[model samples]
Target: MAVRMLINGVAADQVPALDRGLAYGDGLFESIRLVDAVAPLWSRHMRRLVESCGRLRIPPPDTMQLWSEVLEVTRDMPHSVVRITVTRGIGERGYALPAAPQPMRVVAAFAPPQVADSAYAQGVRMRVCDIRLAEQPLLAGMKHLNRLEQVLARAEWSDPAIAEGVLCDSHGRVISATMANLFAVVDGMLLTPALDRCGVAGVARAEVLAACPQTQVGALTLDALLGASEVFLSSSVRGILPVRSLDKQDYPVGGTTRQLQQHWRDLGLRWSRADE
Candidate 1:
């Protein structure tokens, strides 16, 4: 089925070419999964989007109106990936904020790619990306429009066998993956990097931390990662994916990892069913 898009409650085709989002990367976006006509993590995504807009000084659209637009765009789609983007609207040719700012909101729906359930069951292989994430505390956790870093890291490998890349911060401290948050089991405790310097605080990462309050968040070095008993990556789209190896250093999917995976699946199923 063809994807559908809406801009400010109108057909996406009506969007003006002068939209700032197309000219400059002055926007925030959310990639959410719509199951049974409901976006399970809609609230969480909206909260983060609003926070990102506040940080970027972009005026936020009304939440109720935005939700209405999302429903309008996805009304005919059952299971899909929903993308919501908000930009600073049309502006003069300058970096300065427009004298009278009007935000533009775009909501679109696309078929989500088919993922192998076994990948989550058996775990996935990962490589340590040589490309280090530059420390930008201001953009640390928001899903902003700038993503050249991830694009560069992902381009480093074309081998289909490798599923993801583990990234480190500019200071050589392990941060996360190109598209997900990293968690490891060290000394029988779950450890994830502190995202103060870099990395996105993924929705799945937040869920895992909420589910397991004892999970530790702190600075992690490559040495600690190499010596860890097990590792995994988390994202809203991928859920919890165990890391079978890092940079050819192998480790079995630990018991704790599996336990968390099961918990995550249960939560996901519940969320999906709740939308029914």
Candidate 2:
């Protein structure tokens, strides 16, 4: 399948040329995991979408209707990745908001990446990116359309062996990965960087926070991040992925990472070929 897509409830692959989303990157998006026509984390995606739309002053699409469209676009998929995007709609030149803008909604589904068994079994290699995240408290934690920072950071490397790139703020505080939230197991407590200043708050990260009793959120430095007994990255699509190495520093795939992986797997979420 050549990636099914829908634009404003219509079967299409293109959006308006003057769409505010295209022009100004004024939008919010969610990447959902669709299995057997059902999204395991649909609730979290919708909740985050609502919260993101509120943050951007854009109206949210109806959840029931959006669900229907998701099913329609991904009808034949056993396991797929669907992306839902909501933009502030078409606007003329200038950043000024239209008096009453009709939010543009785009829903699309595609085959997921062919994940290697070792990615979950042995774990993934990561690198620390030199591209530091700028502090923008207003845009922090929301999955907004603006992602030039991540694009640049991801461009810092091309080796497919490096599964992800760990990111830090301008002050050298560990924030997250290029596309996932990061967690470090220090001593015995679970520690994740607080996203109050920057970074995306991932759904899988939220689940871990709720599931782990000994969890703490704070501004973690790179030195403090690498001092952990174990490390892992979380994303709604990938679940929990154990970090085997950050550059040359190696971390063993420990029990805590596996426990969370099994937790999501028990929810019927597909991890990878390894999980099967």
- Name the top lDDT candidate: 2
- Assess candidate 1 and give its lDDT: 0.81
Against the true structure, candidate 2 has what lDDT?
0.90
Q: What lDDT would each prediction earn against the true structure?
A: 0.81, 0.90
What shift in Å separates residue 124 of candidate 1 from its native position after superposition? 1.0
Per-residue C-alpha lDDT of model 1 across residues 1-276, encoded as one tens digit per residue: 677888887785566677777777888888877666776567888888888899999999888898887787778666777788899999988788898889998888887765566666667888889899999899888887878889999999999889999889888999999988889888888999999877788777887888889999998999999999988887776667778788768878888777776785555532223223
Task: Look at candidate 2 and give me any clashing residue pairs.
Answer: none
Query: How far does residue 18 in candidate 2 sit from its true spot (Å)?
Result: 0.3
Candidates in order, TM-scores: namely: 0.91, 0.98
| Candidate 2 lDDT score at position 54 | 88
Per-residue lDDT for 1-276 in model 2, tens only? 678999999999899999999999999999998778877778988999999898888988999999999999888788889999999999879999988999999999989767777888888999999999999999999999999999999999999999899999999999999999999988787899999999999877888888896789997889877888999988888888899999889999989999999998887887677566
User: Quick one: RMSD of model 1?
Assistant: 2.8
